[model samples]
Target: MNVAKALLSIMTLTSLTACTALPAGPSRSTGPLVIQEQGSFAAGGKVVSTPGTYDNNNPAAQGQTFHGDHLYAFYQIPQNPKPLPIVMLHGAYQSARSWETTSDGREGFQTLFLRRGFPVYLVDQPRRGRAGNSTVAATIEPTPFDQLFFDQFRIGKWPDYFDNVQFDRKPETLDQFFRSVTPNTGPYDADVISDAMAALFDKTGPGILFSHSQAGGPGWLTAIKSENVKGIVALEPGSGFIFPEGELPREMPSAAGTLTPEAVPLADFERLTRVPIVIYYGDNFPVEPTTERGQDNWRVRLAMARLWVDAINKHGGDAQLVHLPEIGIRGNTHFLMSDLNNVQIANLVSEFLEEKDLD
Candidate 1:
């Protein structure tokens, strides 16, 4: 095992290259941005309490109420913020910190978008990260699966990186990357997460929802539950494409595992059509199934995403899938938002937002 994997065995952990000539980001003055307001709040959860009398001095097993399953969000509003805020949700094994700083110690999307005049809200979903309280309890085993994720994330096979990969491969950077993988404090419940996300939207009002990896499916569910989601930007959502009940496709087989697409009521699935959505994928994905599990897994997802886009567009929805390599942006991993060319990716997203009039 490499240094990163070795360290991850003690803890637990956690990209791609871009092709083409990287485009320049929008020029901005290299000065600190002015923030009008910044703070954090918890949204969406119920209080659970035991029915019994309790004494203040003897509060061990007494009747005590617990507030659990709420999502925590931190926000920053600029002097002249955009109409809609960007609420970012992290994927599995990650927290809102994923958007704060890149593994290479660069400014992350939280600040990058804020500089673009969009109020930014980073979320820690219920039972994860800052939102650790949950109605259901769970035990998180300290399994040494860092190398497993290393392969699964498509940076490269364990202890190796794809040629021309965009990730920062310094040992220290890998250490930071590994340390970012956090365990869920409770069970992974999509309904709970979606409910919490909807609550967050309810509190923040209409805004753009950004979901990465595991949060992708729940993000869709959140939009269905709340009218506050005006737009969606998903980065490499592994699964959770909702199709009309009878239109569900056959389960796809992948080297990593079976790729299962969920079915929802026609009405619920139609909710996605109301908003403009974009999905992005990074590089190093083989066009055909590869013997490597990591590469093959993504190949299947990319194929399914194409079908998903077709379904949404057919339903009169505005959805687009951008495969970075096809567009000449190469060497991107799953975490494109934090990659070395993240600013370029940000500019791309900015253009999309402007095109859709969401900016």
Candidate 2:
């Protein structure tokens, strides 16, 4: 057993080294860096507003669009010689303002990046913050069956469901409930969100996409589909249909029950990929401790990142797997970006981008 353990350890270390050795590809230019701060009357003009924090636990007001409900975003255009623009997508249940406000009362990522001359546009994802306000109250409630399932099976509870949980209440079974709530299904991937972003770009020009968790998948899809996206910074992006073979679980829930067709295989990491990608994961992010099933899910996420790194390298794309130092935080859950030490993490990101000349 000891010998076997040693071999496993060696193999894991070898794999990590191989993954990090991948070369970064040439950078693409969005032409000149043009920072446009003023709102224009162009088709897709810049819409600027004060950063607003929503209850994130309430219903939508009458006639308000989901994307407009609790939505809060801040765009900072530096006056310095044109620098690369970055678009930040918030994690689940969070507003764009959270990136600027520290839970421990420190400066936010927005100010930090802005000071460094990187113009940033922070946005709340669909069904979160200002979007889907009608379901905000549901974010705070525990599902009856979810509670029962945890009690009976002693499995860990699901992460906060937020508006998704409320939408699932009418479904007959848990499986159906899951199908009902995932964002990629309904108004989420809809043009409204994309249009809002495209308009922002029309005013601001080309930019890099930075997204976390569930928002990461959409961010990738949008970047791949839209011409305006120059690169992507995916922080623990959820599994897309184009995942590494044997890395992800076969039984995982499809995005909104719409499984990817066999004809449209998972993304190929090897080959000359168009957009550059930078991936990061929390080293201390915890696997589900209470349930084996939960742990399996966590393992899939870690494995996916490894596979993605390998594939991107083979394809001659610029991809990096960043392992953050465990800063005394037990189980690196998704919310670490909002922590006080986020500056440390952000600095690492800035360094990586600089090293690759991505900015």
Candidate 3:
């Protein structure tokens, strides 16, 4: 985090407060102006390449260590932007825009939460969006544009709509969805992302982390590590746990190049229980769909959420898995934040946070 000296010294930082972005008129509301700032931090650092210098007579490759991955976020405080803040994390292949703007021209959670008088910090996870890249350019590979997400995420069929598709966007909106997709670089390090998140959380005050899908994994880990994280609202976390698949029980790699594998009890994460935890799933999930992959994905995710809720509750953590269909808000997809009924869900989140005393 001290690297602020390294980066800020190199360029001017961009900090956007609520008043600065307002129209030439009154405050958006009677509340404080929303304060927002965006910059990248080296949560954890690593030398990605050997340092070298380019000179008139000779050119050498500058040794570079990836300072963990970059963290790009826009934070808002009311009075304008304040805390008990909600940190929003996007899922795989998506950036923080997951909470900023929707493809249907709808406002993202950032706007909704602001209206509710809570500050918000939105994250672009490593290798995505404002969170920029870390690996050598040649090592980067883009996530394939495929039906995998559409079907698995329950957005719709590849070229057709699945039964009761809840995505609710016009056909033209597909362009926006596609445009939001970016090629990703890997050996994705969940631990580094978690540390960056923790660093950000420590720098800010304790509050909440509202994470979506893949980001849910690290969100759990970050909350586990940081006392600053008071609560976590995980939206359909993958496999219902922190740490990535293929890495097994899950190993967290630090910027210093240390790999810490999962060795703690699920009870350890009950730190979440000290506060409150909620796992929210969208509609059309429990009922089987046409694609075998989608069907299996749904079943697995549902089971995962269930398992987590059970485990967390057993550990004295107040974690609940909510199915939207069961609550009268149906036809939602994995991307519930952008659904036509998004406001309904955001309201549910706001009310839950208020009830839990997170607000």
Q: What lDDT tens digits, residue by residue, belong to model 1 across residues 1-359?
A: 69878877645422112311232222332356678899999999989888888889878655988999999999998877889999999999999998989999999999999888899999999999999998898998998988888788877888998887889989998889989999999999888999999999988999999999989889999999999999999999886878988988887888888888899999998999999999999998897977889888899888888889899999899999999999999999889889999999998999999999999
List all candidate RMSDs to the true structure: 13.5, 17.8, 12.4
The local distance difference test score of each candidate is: 0.89, 0.51, 0.69
Better of 1 and 2 by TM-score: 1
- Collision count for each candidate, in order: 13, 18, 31
**What is the RMSD of candidate 1?**
13.5
CA deviation > 4 Å runs, candidate 3:
1-44, 47-57, 62-68, 80-82, 135-144, 240-263, 287-291
lDDT of 2 by residue, 155-210 (tens): 22454332211112222433432222222112344234545555555556677777
Could you tell me which 10 consecutive residues in candidate 2 have the lowest summed lDDT?
Answer: 255-264
Looking at model 3, report the run of 10 residues with the lowest lDDT sum: 250-259
Candidate 1 TM-score, true structure as reference: 0.91
lDDT per residue as tens, model 3, 135-173? 635365564755767776777656766566656457667
Ranking by TM-score: 1, 3, 2
Q: What ranking of all candidate models by lDDT puts the best one first? A: 1, 3, 2
Highest TM-score, which number? 1
Winner by lDDT between candidate 2 and candidate 1: 1
